[model samples]
Target chain A: MNPIRKVLRAGFELIERPFDRLFGPALNPVAQLGALGFFFFWIVAVSGIYLFIFFDTGIERAYQSVEYISRDQWFHAGVMRSFHRYASDLMVVMVLVHLLREFAYDHYRGVRWFSWFTGLPIIWLLYVSGITGYWLVWDKLAQFVALVSSELLDWLPIFGEPIARNFIATGTLTSRFFSLMVFMHVAVPLFLLFIMWVHILRISRPKVNPPRMLALMSLAALLAVSIWKPALSQGPADLARVPNGIGLDWFYLPLYPLTELWGNGSVWAFLTAFSLMIALMPWLPPLRRARAAEVDLEHCNGCARCAEDCPYEAIKMVRRTDDLPFPTEAEVNPSLCVSCGICVGSCPSSTPFRRTEELKTGIDLPEYSLRQLRERVMDVASGLSGPGRVLVLACEHGGAAGRIGDTVVMPCVAMAPPSLIDFILSRDLADGVVVAGCAESACYNRLGVQWTEQRFAAERDPYLRARVPRERIATVWASALAASKAEAEIVEFAARVAAMPPKRLRSPLPVSSTVPTPKALQTERGTT
Target chain B: MKALRWIGQFVVIAALFAGVAALSDWPRYSQIPKDAGVVMLSFVHGADRKGECRRLTPEEIAKLPPNMRRVQDCPRGRRAVYVELDVDGRSAYRADLPPTGIAGDGPSRVYQRFVLPAGRHDVAVRMRDSARADGFDHESRKSVELMPDQMLVIDYRPENGSFIFR
Candidate 1:
């Protein structure tokens, strides 16, 4: 091989032998989140279908159907309603977490700009989906959703059509609006998934699955939730009355707090500006510079691995006409590079390809796994039986799990779907589910904590208009370097959940509603 | 004036009769209820060659060369799947699942249920494939609102070789 070819070949070889040491990379945090998110979606989809079977789309019947499903079919229909609502909340969270992890890790700045740009719209899409669900319930919250949505649209000047008054109109029940929401709920995601394939195509080694335990746990939890809580709605959408403290889904409704702080228009301005800035984020200075990639011609191979491996598409293949002997080679687009080392990690070909300086470059080892490792710690604390198992789910940073006060640890918290969280809580399966993760940026696989907390938050989604306050899900974060902090956080969360009154082990409702145990309902389920 | 009114209605009635004869065997004499509820369904599984559902458009049919109104599902003599409406909810609408279940049972054969209050109703049906969609049969089924607890069905059984509504 020529000198330049030899050099390029060597650069590629360093990636092939990534450090395999540690408790074995059972899961990559990013992959774990994706796997968990997929299961969460199915949870939503299945429960949504169940709710659909009984959903009445009219003024009088819509609320009645929801009531029948929640109050009568509490085990099946009720659980599905809650699961669907909760799972949706979780899915949005996972997506956001994935975005944040990628962003903090500098994965959003480089050639992957296209992927980032395309994905930004998905945030809006998720919001629309959640709002649509609210409307589908046709409850007080839904009425608020419907009114706000229409008021927003009414500001637009597109009503000049001569025959736009057959059914759905601004002042009345519009078949048009319902049709639009239905179309958006399903279609937007389909479009997003299509774009996602394109985004991943630019990168090699895209993970589409989570760990086995994570996947199963998510599915089990979703099923358990759908069965236990079964999502239902509140009363019919009473547009005339605004219910105080109508339970709100805080994940997507984080914007609600903003709305509360700054009334509508200013918030809209904030959002518009924020969105536009994000869409144009790659243009931000200094962020437009390389975070950690440099092309060494001596170590580089012309395989275009960097180009293919970059999640953000930061590298491009260019001709090696200047100084270099090879006719073709690849160059890093410094401005767009996320320096994720995926390209560096995926490379390994024969020397006949060429040679380059082999930096003893090692893959930051993968420590992601999802065993109830925390359960073992719980046993040590004697917390499992004494108070009931406080399930502290901590992230597997590089290889080992972290324990706080002798409790749980795992990979990304997203891996545990709310169903699992609820299952452990409702069945008294575990005393609590304490999720410890790396700070969003430090997560090696990206999006570990985001998913974990999101799924935890999903438990509280008020789909049936029943606000199930999130059960025993908490987050504590630190860098992989700080194992002690990781331990401290998990223990604190478990202690908190375990200390609560045993009667508070009530199935996922807020600590307030003074209604006696739906003993008849609970008995029916136990019998089943 | 009386004679003129009589002549005008007679002419109008004659025109309607001629137009009805020219198009469909059954002509709608009255408009169905405006509030009639229905579920829009793609009952035929993989009915669209793409295995995706599509809304029909007018230009789609305009491209057809008149001779091909009905397209065959396969070259073999197997009876091709065709859309059949189930007016009764699932209890009255029986779809043969066989060993393969809902997936093997095409969407055209599977009947979904739709319930509406007592009033007039106008339902539509159409066929779609990967590349194009067949012209829709708009206002194809019209029914007077059934009294409470009443039932109705629009059957298209090729084996029986006829379309019937009750």
Candidate 2:
């Protein structure tokens, strides 16, 4: 009995050690960011798989496949489409949040600067992925993306040269190379995983996933949203037509607003400055003497553990042959220091060449005022409508319902987030949200209103089925509604939403199947 | 109300542009609309280039020994086979070599073209016995992978066997 007990104990110790090392390592605020990032990646993968099965690449078959998926097999394909679109936005949001949190926390100095530096490319890739996804629809948006990309590239020196000539060589788009673009759109995410791994390597405690419950709920919500309102593909691109109002994604596309304020070249300059200025933040006015890292001379043991663990490789040891306590004294580089506190945590001997909190004494949130800002945002959302059960949209399309309780909120619906969406939905603040976009890719700013639609496409952008089922959220490309089109739509949409049974807020996670059982399949089909 | 009407007019004009886009996309719909019927249209792609559908130029006849040349088919008729040879003269892409009256996975699909007359007809793919005899075999080879649903055009001199009716 004693021997068996000892063996079981040994097995547990072996298992528990790894878990403890992973979870309870050094102090980490940035680990939460990693967890959220992984959560969104999972959403992206699940949605991509759903999208790929239905994506057709032929010139004639592309739009057709989208139509079949949205309208014909909408019950199943719709859910999958929603998952893909919603998860894409969710992942991007998580990534942005993670980057901002790290920046605010001052985790990008010294040895850790490499991770910070490499992260710029990761953000670029994410936007490109979003752009490619938009183009896959072969709608007006795809046409616009093509036009803009061509125009941008045309100004470069290579167009008449071999490189540009080969690229625009009339027949290549119709050749085997076109197939490669399809393959690449599917494969680029695999490369992004490596970039993320390196990004989180500086931290001792890195979370590769979110809490189990949140993951499952997010997946379920995505699936539910997809089912409620299947994604719709506009007809094939028409170069001749002009569309009215289009949806916009404001996060990455905030540049769109600038375009409205400025023309092409100046806007381009603004974007370039925006990225470069952030990159050049460390070179700003030097930190105050107190804010810079300083050594606690009394605790100095010269063990050099901090130097070993530093991610930016910023610490250097000076050799003094004749000095009393010297042979290997440590010095910290102020220019390279990110103040992430890896050195503070790694020191076995209680000697810190620089203090972590001291370096960040003057730190504050990037936003001007958290409390005042929150109140202002809430006010804006609330103030959009005149009264009860208001529908806030970016466009003025859906006011025809005039059902005493219904109203359209804003000029563009893409500005609202799932959180804002949740606040309104939970309080029964609005009866519904009807986002009618211009034809896909028709936004003048080259902003992805459709991409925004895709991101918030989930049944619960804030939380699945928290207030309304996914079906209540929709993306319709409105030219002008015929004489009575806007009125008919408003009345139609409001009545339909009002008619829906209250949403059941079950944990909005996708149900997974390790084994494909018959019962599981039936339950998956909404039988249970 | 008048200002509102003006804004509404602007929106409608934009919408009209969208409607025109929709209208143009109608015939290109993925699924045949309920109102669709057998419309007269050619399956126009790169059929002629893929098929051996080139006219023999007058200079070529003069270059050829006069005794070997015979009055062949019409100069402007579609041929049965198209051979696309690679730059190095190796066999590359071929079209219209399958047995007539059948369409399946093989060398080529059977011609159901209304433009081509229905019958057992002598056809020329890339090169035939006469073209070989006239030393015009160089024009018959093309290098490409045979794909499903490919279209091509072959040109033959003899108009009798060359008229396409599908």
Candidate 3:
């Protein structure tokens, strides 16, 4: 990592650590910032639908109807109005935080760039939709927004004459105008939803919504806010006179003041430039793509385990073309692959019992295969001389600085199959094994830390056998910048292992007993 | 214990929301002010005189595609109207009202407001509808008494060929 990025990451962690400490890991706001944005959107959508029921989209009646909802129905409809406004504002705040978090964590480059690039337009679309929603009230703020927006639009030479004339005075605006504004307020959100969906398309098993308890709490909070301070409109729009000043929603309408300070053209120029820079940020410091995974049809059983475990959805199960004696085979799509190699861990053919010339798995990363990974694990475990001899299977992205001896780095800790851990401890290659990777929620590969945890807990496939003592292994999640924490965890784990008695290993099975016969392997693979 | 902690977090979030809502002190529905006076200036400017195209001949129409042909080759563009207002011998407002709505060419309408003290004052308004640089196509000047919180309206009627005040 470059010095600039390292400093930035350090700064971000410094700011974030306090919140993690205060809120505890599970309730950490920073960890769940992305999902919070989605939760806020739901609140906005629900409240907006409620507001739409009482809304009157006519130039003359728009303000009056909104006033009626605000005053006459203050308890229900009025609160809903406030909820809609505040939730929309909160959504923008959360989206910005989420963006900053992704950048701070350096998750916006290489394969993750798609999510970042798709997110840029969402901010603008959200602003447009939110501004249109305010316009529906036809209040003083709406008048100011419409005027400034029209002035901005007029900056473009596409129109023959200035569009600002529409809001020049009373009676100039018609119901058709209000109708179009309402249409945009409705339609733009649906378009934004499509964009958000596309933003997560590259990710497998995307968590679009936050946890259930968090969602409920968020909704309750929004409701409480709405009831306490109902959303109210400013005085009705009068285009005949210039407004002195209107209360501004800095979240969505930050650019309105800029229009006043600098002319419309300069504001447009600044916004265009800023957006362009953000869109091109992924390439500012170009990152080399990780090696793509490769599949050997000879070993693949068409079980689709790798496809299911892939965090990037890079692997697909296709019909076997050759006479490989398999009905289907997993194929890795190079363009989508991040090469975290979690799929290699998911492959049952990745067992250490293989005595072939090369320790080939059904699917493997070009740079690091399961065979090479096993050899590294063995080398690290055997090399340890002291009594507290510990083998730490660490993620390359995880903040393992090689401070603790006997460390073997995998692309992700999930790339280390449970069998590998079993092989190390059962064979007495190491007194203890410690698995460490990126923070569970903040995993660079999304599901790497999560799947690793599940695998270690014996809750998922390729589970650590019941015979393997749970106390012999430990899983620690830390970011690449948090190497100190990972080192401390390894030291603590080594101490705990040292306190326990020596491992009682079962007699080793013969190669034939553990490894599947060639004919049986092909037949068993066919059923999967 | 875990469930209790989860519930406690939920309570804290709810309390935070209530606290923020109270602290914000947002305007209530019943608090809308009613004493402010509104001055309405509404008018659709007369059609542009410059760049007005003549009607196409029957032979010319026959030569064009069905979608392209129009019975009359009317002017596609309308000239903007210049409007100026003065109060108490001082220029108060000025704007060039464009022809039509945002999407296409249509009658150019303008609405504006000016809040003044409740008293009698001399008001003057002028508009140039066409491309002529000579003078205003229509003009109005008057001393009008305005009551406190009164709604004053200024309108133009092409049929009457004059500005109307109320």
Candidate closest to the true structure, highest DockQ: 3
lDDT tens string, model 3, B1-166? 7777766766666665655444332232111123444455667665573476788889999999988998777656677778888888888888887776554366666666577766787889898888787689889998887665555777788888788886
TM-score of chain B of 1: 0.33
Which tens-of-lDDT digit does each residue in B10-44 have in candidate 2?
34323422332223223321111232211111111
Ranking by lDDT: 3, 1, 2
Q: Compared with the true structure, what per-residue lDDT tens digits does model 1 show for residues A1-528?
A: 235434432332222112111111343233345555555666666777777788766655666878888898877777777667767777776787667545544556556677678777767766776777777667755664564454344334332211211112223364455556566766766665566565556554555566564455455555554454345554565432332235555565555434435655667788789899879876663243325455656545566644654454556788874565666666666545444444443333211111123222111112211112222332333434566356665555521264445444433443343444443455454566565665443454453444344334443221111222354556665545456655666566657766776634545433222211234334545789
Top candidate (TM-score): 3
- Of 1 and 3, which scores higher on TM-score? 3
Alpha-carbon runs more than 4 Å astray in model 2: A1-31, A110-112, A161-180, A251-261, A286-528, B1-166
- Among these predictions, the greatest lDDT belongs to 3
Note the Cα lDDT for every prediction shown.
0.48, 0.44, 0.77
lDDT at A304, model 1: 68
Docking class of 2: incorrect
Every candidate's fraction of true contacts kept comes to: 0.00, 0.00, 0.14
For candidate 2 chain B, which ten residues in a row score worst on lDDT? Answer: B37-46
- On lDDT, who's better, 1 or 2? 1
All candidates: TM-score: 0.42, 0.39, 0.80
Output the TM-score of candidate 2: 0.39
Q: Is candidate 2 or candidate 3 better by DockQ?
A: 3
